[model samples]
Target: AQSVTQLDSQVPVFEEAPVELRCNYSSSVSVYLFWYVQYPNQGLQLLLKYLSGSTLVESINGFEAEFNKSQTSFHLRKPSVHISDTAEYFCAVSDQSNYGGSQGNLIFGKGTKLSVKP
Candidate 1:
């Protein structure tokens, strides 16, 4: 079945450091890629998405990801992170294109926990 995979369960970084969260997806039909961030004690918030157009997408908070069709990957990245950046990041895929008029849901990965230290 179609699924999303998060290569790292956890990532630790200093107050100011670069980080990358790896993600890969497998699906028979076309899909939309999304990256979500869940801060502590809060709901998941959309970080970025790739539906069409440029393969590269970025979030307002300095996060970015590139959709690679050949590799079936959409890895999340940040050039520099702060303590507030600590959170659980999830990679998700939606087969909305194939669903046509039907309701669609996101297929999420296990998630990568990002821990930022002082």
Candidate 2:
């Protein structure tokens, strides 16, 4: 199965701290990468994606991730995080066919809980 794995179950940091959420994947064929953030009791927002061109992608909010084809990984990073960034971060993957197409139900990792202290 084409699946994503988030190694860190949770990452706690103070406001304005830097953070990283690790992720890995295993797929038989090509795949699209994504990082989605979910606020407390809220739906997820698309943080970023690695589709075709660039290996590195960023979100408007300062989060970024690099798609490492060799390592089969896509890890999220933020130079300085805020308390608002406290949320659950999910790493996902879709088959190449579903990249631009309908994002069919995403295959999600268990998720990494990011807690930013005030």
Candidate 3:
């Protein structure tokens, strides 16, 4: 089984300031990591993912995350944030070894609320 943990429940930052959302995971088997963001009154959208090969992944936006296997962490970061970036961020992990059952099922952490203020 795989599980994710978000270190902070809420992160408040000023617009244009750098921010990081910490995420950690534990798994008995190989896993894939993902960051999902949900804007106000919107559904969850895939932000970035680390399946294999490269350890770092970036979203279409300015956000980027590095998959550190040794640390068991995939922390999301941005050099500068905007008011539009305010949202609930979730860290999820999928068991890559499990292909037959619950194919798309992912274990998720309690979301972190990112609040960007002016």
Candidate 4:
């Protein structure tokens, strides 16, 4: 079985400040990692994913995550954040057993709320 843990429940940062949301996972087999973000009054949206190749994956919105196999961590980071970056971030994982690229069986973390202040 695979499980995900997000280290922080909330992260408060000033605008233009850097931020990092930590996530760790435990699994006996190969797995895929993903970051999902939910803005106010919106559904969760995929921020980035790590399927294969490239230990580091990035999202268009200036967020990046690195897959560290040794540490079993997929931490999301942004050099500078804006007020719009405030949202709920979720870390999810899917083992190889989940067939056909389906995202139905993903294990999710408790979620981290990013609060960007002026």
Query: Pick by lDDT: which candidate is best?
Result: 4
- What C-alpha lDDT do the candidate models reach, one value each? 0.92, 0.90, 0.94, 0.95
Tell me the tens digit of each residue's lDDT in model 2 across 1-118. Answer: 6888899998999999899999999989788889988988899888899888989999999999999999999999999999889899999988876645537667899999999998
Q: Give the distance in Å from residue 114's predicted Cα in candidate 3 to where it truly belongs.
A: 0.3
Runs of candidate 4 with Cα error greater than 4 angstroms are 100-104
Ranking by lDDT: 4, 3, 1, 2
Model 3 weakest lDDT span, ten residues long: 96-105
Collision pairs in model 1 = none
Q: Which pairs of residues have clashing backbones in candidate 3?
A: none
**Candidate 3: misplaced stretches above 4 Å?**
100-102
Residue 82, candidate 2: how far off, in angstroms?
0.6
Model 1 lDDT tens row, 1-118 = 4699999999999988999999999999888899989998899998999988999999998999999999999999999999999999999998856557214888899999999999
Instruction: Write one digit per residue (lDDT tens) for candidate 4, span 50-107.
Output: 9999999999999999999999999999999999999999999998766757365999
Candidate 1: worst-modelled 10 consecutive residues by lDDT = 96-105
In candidate 3, what are the lDDT values of residues 1-118, reduced to their tens digit?
Answer: 7889999999999999999999999998888899999999999999998988999899989999999999999999999999999999999999887875336689999999999999
Candidate 4, position 11, lDDT: 96
| Candidate 2, residue 4: lDDT | 84
